[model samples]
Target: MSMQLNYNWLLVLLSYAVSVLGSFTALQLAVAIPLAATQRQKTAAVVMAGGAMGLGAIWAMHFIAMLACDNGMDVSYDASLTALSALVAFAACVAGLMLVGSGRFDWLRLLAAGICMGLGVAAMHYIGMAAMMMPAKISYASGLVALSVVIAMVASTVALWLAFNLRGPLQMIGSALVMGVAVCGMHYTGMAAASFEDNGGQLPDGYAEGLRGGNLGLTIFVVVTILLVLMLVLHYWRQRYRSSISI
Candidate 1:
């Protein structure tokens, strides 16, 4: 039997909102990379930006979207795989940000960075998907899977371009919006790629010990709260710095 999958629309919206907030925060940090006079400052900015994008925008949003999914089964996540997915997301974002943030921005760098970030997002999504533990076996359609990856790469490229190459408020706002598209589009598309089949009600090993929806919900709440506070801090810091510079 094939499991009928559905989603909570509100949680889906919340996932997108989290993605935008994370993107805005990351891009705000990213715009300062070129202005960093020291290698340490540049490295710090890159790492921070990477964390925001990877952990906050990509990983957190992925899980929230997962929570929004109701696959008509009792599902839990493998803690180890879940953690690995997050690390992958963080590492990929860091590499992409570092590549584009260093030296002069060029087309080649942007292309490479986009590929890195896009593939990272895709990989994180699938890996996170793999973390699901239920009485069903999952599979993907090759066509939609490929489409999801392409959507990620193309939109991620566009988002990075908007993030680093834009001016004033548009710099943060535009990239964040497009990046939300990159994150959410790839996600739902990937979800569309998946088909779940029943396995005679046989649950995977350790399903009893896996992280449940309640656990994930609490984690996501904390993450969103942190992201909101970070955005506010960034806003305040930017305002004060601008005022001081103009004085």
Candidate 2:
């Protein structure tokens, strides 16, 4: 039973690691360059734009990642369902945008963003699951799994955002990486929580084993090392090639 629980934990961590590494890296690539391009005078605009770009990129990455994984399979799931979900999310976002722009205390904006994220992540996973579903009948277990994923993602976002804000901007960049991992971790944890049977089949296990066997630890080490080296080399190259912008 303990072993089963451990395995379930492992599954969550593994899934989170995938999101952090894949989606986060994509986020950096998507947002960082644009931020660098903007001058200090336009800092606020750049910052906001960078954020919008980051979230947009994350969504794009999630969709494409699932679609890529779905390759050649019969994704006979209803296109309208996915479309409607996206439309609702868009409308919600628009409303949030208006609320924020209207200059009220904007409590609603935050709530809306949270709801948008939860639904967006949930819809993506459900649609992906639908695409991946075998002809076997759907069950309540599936709905629970979906709920778990959504809750985990929303929790992760809150956690990561808190962690990021606690740190300053320089640290915020690193926090974003942490946030990425948290997002992915939460997502997969949710996936793992899904009970396949009414009685709840043996709880999952394997945090350590999954870390090693799943190759997540190795992948993180390799990727982070490479990215660090790349960053160092780029830092030096930039110093040699371009004058630093004076604040």
Candidate 3:
């Protein structure tokens, strides 16, 4: 028998929304990274902001997308692995931000930063997949995985370039939209790369057995919404303070 993957379209749409919101916030933070008054402040801001972006954009988006997936089997996740995957995502985002925001705008640096960011995003995806504790063994197509990584790298490079080069609200909005599409594209492509084999194994204890797709989606939605609001408030406050100081 052939295995089929089913997805809840509603949840998939919600995942995309989460991605967009995360990308927008990340872009805003990226733009602000270079504007810090001091080197220490810039580094700290980049790490914190990058972690927040990774949490919402990469980690949360991946989780929500997984929630949308159904392989006609009972699926749960290893709590520790899941949490660790988020940390990995945050670290990757921080590395990417640091590389791009390092006060140097060169092709080599951009390429290096893009590759690092791409690999980080891809690593987060695969790691999160590993966290799934289902009664099956998971595998991947090598080609699709490579393609997804390429998409992530290219998109990440573009996003970083836009973050560094673009000015004003309209440009930022456009960059966010494009970056969101890139993030979603990489995710779905990675999903396409995955296949499961029934191993007749049992799910382990202490996994995320109680969480369902809808419930997880609702939780992510609420969390991301709150984060977005907080980010906006911080951005505006920072802007106002900077304006006052410049006078």
Clashing pairs in 1: none
Model 2, span 1-247: residue lDDT tens: 1111123344334434444443333333323222344444234332332233233323332333333322222223344544454354334333333332333334454455556555555655555444323223223356667666566446434532332234244554555566655555444544454333222332223222211123433444345435534543553465456555542
- TM-score-wise, the better of 2 and 3 is 3
Candidate 1 runs further than 4 Å off:
231-235, 238-247
Please provide TM-scores, in order, for all candidate models, with all chains considered together. 0.92, 0.43, 0.93
lDDT of each: 0.85, 0.39, 0.81
lDDT of 1: 0.85
Ranking by lDDT: 1, 3, 2
Candidate 2: C-alpha RMSD to true structure equals 10.3
Worst 10 residues of 3 by lDDT: 205-214
Q: What's the TM for model 3?
A: 0.93
TM-score of 2: 0.43
Put down candidate 3 lDDT per residue, 109-223, tens digits, no spaces: 8889888988888888888888888777788899999999999889878877876787787877777777778888999999999888787766656555534454877688778
As for candidate 3, its clashing pairs are none
